[model samples]
Target: MGSGLPRSIRFDERVSERLTSYVARHPGWSGSSAANRFVDEALRMEDHPGVIFRDGPADRRAVLVGGPDVREVIRSVKSARASEPDLDAGMVVSLVSTNAGVPARLIDTAIRYWAAYPDEIDVWIDEVESFEEQSLLAWERRQDLLAR
Candidate 1:
């Protein structure tokens, strides 16, 4: 039940138990309220085309839109702008969509989310860059060892 309106729905025994547990763990949330929040979140996610939150490495949540990580979308757009300083948003969207095979709408959604939560995407981008640099350094070391 929500404050604005109430509706009745049936849940399986396991679902009911889980809802109860969730409400118990989260103070100030009744089972009905928790269910309402979950439903609302689900609906909101549904409205965002091609955007989904999934567990990334180490079980951290990551946003994926249009088959690419949100960071990837941001990186692509950034790189495009860097190369062509005058490219507008629409042009960037078209370029990213063509290169990434993601629809413009999805790219727009990713960009919007990135704008709202830049720190999260920046962290992911930094992690990826660090991993790549480390990998390259390791490979170079191995090559030197083999040459020696």
Candidate 2:
């Protein structure tokens, strides 16, 4: 107690109040610990910037919308409810219709795929690709039939 060393910083009244709420929300974890962990992770990300957003290829159709980037979209999908199939459907519809500049009905199959696989957009893309391939094949068959 008689050592002349500096002491640790103490939480002020305002910080203490916020910490109390945080502690209540996350049981078994202290407010300071939570704050420290979040700050540490944020600082680590700053040190090594990951793919929060990347420039699309020169030939790719990429447009930033709603002031929210891909990372925010990913976060939103993660935090959304497990039973939110309709919400995921709407998201898929919006993305496909917006990107393809086609009617939503054309991308209904993609929406259904996304609804089934809410956490993964890869499956939805596969479904869209299959739909495109089938349409092209059908068009080619029709062209042959017309020439016959």
lDDT of 1 by residue, 33-115 (tens): 87876776466467655667665673334356437777888888888889988988899899988998888887888887777
Model 2, 78-137: lDDT tens digits are 444343455665775565456546445534433333344355454434454587799999
lDDT of each: 0.78, 0.48
Query: What TM-score fits each model?
Result: 0.67, 0.27
Residue 74's lDDT within candidate 2 is: 34
Candidate 2 yields a Cα-based lDDT of 0.48
Inter-residue clash pairs, candidate 2: none
Candidate that would win on TM-score: 1
